[model samples]
Target: MEKQIDNHYRYLQQHFSYLIRQQALLPGEKLPSERDIGERFNLTRMTVRQGLQTLEAEGLIYRQNRRGWFVSPPAVVYNPARRQSFIEYVSSQGFEPSTDLIGVTVNPADARMAELMKVDKGARLLFLQRRRSIDGRPVLIEHIYINTALLPGIEKEDMSQSLTHLLRNKYGQAYHSMNLIFKSTALLEDAARELGAAAGLPGLHIERTNYDAAGRVLELDYEYWRHDAVTIQIDVNDA
Candidate 1:
């Protein structure tokens, strides 16, 4: 029975995958209802859903709450090695970029944060939560911890604009370098909800520590990105 179910789901997966590849299902085009698909394929709704999920994991389709699934748009190319801000890189790729300030607060650093920032525990940090979108589709959630000691009064500035711009123009500081880590992980429930993605969906997790000319950590960034929304590309360095 298990083997039969697997075959059924694989068939369903291939059916949709082929159509999407042929462009019969264009970007932003909606797929048939799950019930409809199940009936048409003579499969259980669970099997139909399993197949659709396989396509989703492959970055071919996405679902919106109450609206059903739609063919995913082109993935935004992201270069972590590039020194470009999200707005800069995204716009350079010809996609519209926008940011929404989810919330901002000041919090005392914990032991782990202190170690990461090279600051004493209880040092105040400016925390910002932001949602970034491409072409009006929310794709990334940013949880940024700024060492306010390095860039005082930053909390007073507009939080929605690019922090890199603020750092350069007002504070006279820039991202001189960064320590970065990337992982493929399941999206946190809250982050998934914010991105309009399913809970526990696979996502790209990026942890970046931006530094100043003095090699001091300026900001620590935790980025959660929708799996289908972006692709990572790293240039080979001959040196």
Candidate 2:
């Protein structure tokens, strides 16, 4: 009986990890109760709990007192020198990447937006907003301000797909983005709803200014990421 219990716990842990990696268990989503897991697996509640505890120790999941276990959001690390697309960075972590377009339109530049993108006041600009997911879990929300002077036909673009790919292939543009700043913030009501996160919870806020080959400010973007679901990796060489 003891051996059987140990095996059951191990099996449960393995299966749970698989679900997490496959994104079947989404970030911020509560895991079924131990009793529920046991009922499904035909195991004892203790056995199910052992599996969940292992995941918690690994920082892949968390238990909030009586709130139950949930997938942990990613951690964010700021590296000033790295240049990579958000998709590329996320994919390298062995997760499926997807984006949900929230809003996309061309509009007159506002005072602040104009200053950020270095476009003129009332200049036509493109606004793109999206919610990004990994393994079917919402983790980040991004808003992009693009100067229409550089890319005139943005309204006709199908940005429900990859914006980076579009810029690279269609415009023959190679963009290198620099991180202007990053800070931690609490989720607003709108952001909380989109991410299924609790309102006022901590999130990672990133502000970036992207440049073109001629050092022109191509776009300015803001990204809000789930604090526990992502991490930045960087290696430093002697300078």
Q: lDDT winner among the candidates?
A: 1
lDDT tens per residue, model 1, 62-160: 988889999999998888778888999999999999999999999999999999999999999999999999988899999999999999898899999
Weakest 10 consecutive residues of candidate 2 by summed lDDT = 75-84
Per-residue CA lDDT of candidate 2, range 106-131, in tens?
89998987888777889888888999
Model 2 / residue 29 / CA error / Å? 9.5
Q: For candidate 1, which ten residues in a row score worst on lDDT?
A: 45-54
Regions of candidate 2 where Cα sits further than 4 Å from its true position: 1-69, 73-82
Model 1 ranges off by over 4 Å: none
Q: Cα lDDT of model 2 overall?
A: 0.77
